[model samples]
Target: MEEMIKLNSDISVFLYDVLTKRQEKNAKYSLRAFARDLGISPGRVSELLHGRRLPGRDLILRIADALKLSPLETEGLFRLVHRQKLVQKENGGARQLLADEYAMVADLECYGLLMLMETEGFKSDIEWIARRLNVTALRVQSILERLERLNLIRSRYGVYERLQHRVTSTHDTPSDVLKESHANVMKHAMEALYNVDLNLRDITSITIPADPDKLSQAKEEIRLFRRKMAKIMGSGKTREVYNLNIQLVPITK
Candidate 1:
């Protein structure tokens, strides 16, 4: 119904956001240029990015191919869109976990399959998932065992499943807090590293007016900066910032 379509729209927007971020990081072409290259209107591309339209399967595949996204990424996007549609049709009572949550579950090997099983009321057990994933029963058992150990999942009647109590409470947490937390973590980590690099370069710069004494002072400052940077990088807890982009750069003097 209409709600289903709206859910589809929301899911489409989420996919668009992921793809757009990837494109922004990797693509050199402007959005208009890229749209032209893909034989679509710029406005249409904008609509897709803004989640005003639900892209068809064919278009989704085409866009994935055009963006050079990996099969995993493409499948993830498709799954999100499909789940959104299902949730919308089901009265929108379920909470929608963001990509980070998906990533976390993926790390535990309990993302896609767990969500599907939960939604479909299937018993999350080795046998059930072994058949679904077309994997060996032993492998599925190992995964379920690990999940149970982490307390992320539990077992009932030999069926393994995510703990219902641990589900993301998106309804209780304000969206702004979630967004701000993510942004702050990503920003601070990036800025910290960037500042370190800049300071190193400043220390290395040898201008005509730079006296020997000033150069020595700069070297000491650089040493302090390097130590501070090392400390920041070594802090395991502080590195929890969600940064997907590679910031490695070759400095040219």
Candidate 2:
């Protein structure tokens, strides 16, 4: 239990630092090589650093032994291992929790429900939310429950609050899940284009011939614009949910 109290607090940072330092010393050090040295699969190391998986006791000890950790680091590693056990016992481990959230996001209505929860006129009533979002009240209730379980949203006095306001996806999100989400969002946008009033919707697109080399810089520009929009929208005056999708693809053959 002493180890549990003295844990590293963030194993992701520790493993990333170790990988970086080792790469500095060994020019040819790849993620595969790093994982081999630590006696684990490259995929496992990737997942650990990405905050998708947690290591068990034996694997943690083996990693420490292979890294030839300092005495203090060994203590810290043991603590990390013990902490993982406790988290697993209490929350069914990181993978299970992430999987549940991923599955939740797979449902487009659930995704819309989260965004709708942020509107100033947000309603805690499932029937209201379902009617507003064009989904069933039962589904709205179920999605709210799932969101609460995943800690993505919290409830107090029956009002739902978004726990994580930053809208971002995991680095290692499944491709199919992302694709399906994109498809659903596209369908919604198409429907809105015809149904929503011009004063309430903004949809514009341009087709231009562009150099491929400049596309990377264009992407950076979009990223910066999105970040700026997020900050501007953070002023506590949010009254509506909007989707801003930027697309850059080849059209010239």
Candidate 3:
């Protein structure tokens, strides 16, 4: 069983995967039950699973002991958790500022180009990137230069390499830039609705009454959901690049 199990870099994903498998064997098992087994509060477990909190060394050890992870898996979890701490630190400081600044003028195409570099069969050729993004070769070349200047991408031995695994524009992103970025993505979402096959795209919405005061919590949940999907979709052999746009807006006054 240990040999068959694979570990995910995201601790939340790893924990959830174990819970899910256990649930498969015992249908009545639930998060609360799992929390009891792990010797933590249900609320605490929920927060960890939802990405609202990061586990510390003690908590990691408790989880490892409860889950009976192999030594290799336990060490892998420690590494991943430490890496996550570093990322969180970066996101709260200078790296996040650089990312936000890049987003302000980078445009949608620039973001797309960055992700494209991660896909399988990716080539460093300007024309190839331009064709993939439906932009001019000049546009792709210019974006490459801008990214290189930012040290977000670098050319080594004739190969372009991506430096950042993620880029997000959060609270500090200029209002105008944030608006324009959303507008650009919304336009593409509209286009995909008509031109792209349903199998390739998921464009849907739900209309429900929601309290204004709780919006902050809702937005955080959406952010967590996006991160979870990013990890899941990015697993295995990534062959193509895709956009994930989730919008929750108020239609009623």
* The best candidate in terms of lDDT: 3
- Return the lDDT, model 1, position 78: 77
Which regions of candidate 3 fall more than 4 Å away from where they truly are? 1-87, 90-94, 103-105
Please report, in order, the local distance difference test score of every candidate based on alpha carbons. 0.51, 0.70, 0.75
lDDT-best of 1 and 3: 3
lDDT of 3 by residue, 1-253 (tens): 2432343435555666677778889989988899999999999997676455779999998988898888887777788777667766757421233345556344778888888888999999988888899999998888888876554566755899774455554455567777787898899999989999999888888889889999999999998898799899999999878889888888976
Residue-wise C-alpha lDDT for candidate 2, range 1-253, written one tens digit per residue: 2342243344654676577667779868888998898888999987776556667777777887887776677777777656655655554343232333575667668767887887778888888998887888888888888876555666656888774443344445678877887888788889989999999988899888788999889998998897688678756888766776666779777
TM-score of each: 0.30, 0.59, 0.62
TM-score between model 2 and native? 0.59
The TM-score of predicted model 1 comes to 0.30
* Candidate 1: tens digits of C-alpha lDDT, residues 1-253: 2222233324434434444455668776466776775567788776654344556798778776766667776776577667655654453333344444433333323433444444444655567677765468897777666545433455545565453222332333455655555555456555656665664332222325444557567766766675577467546533121222222222444
Best by TM-score: 3
Ranking of predictions according to lDDT: 3, 2, 1
The count of backbone overlaps in candidate 1 is 1
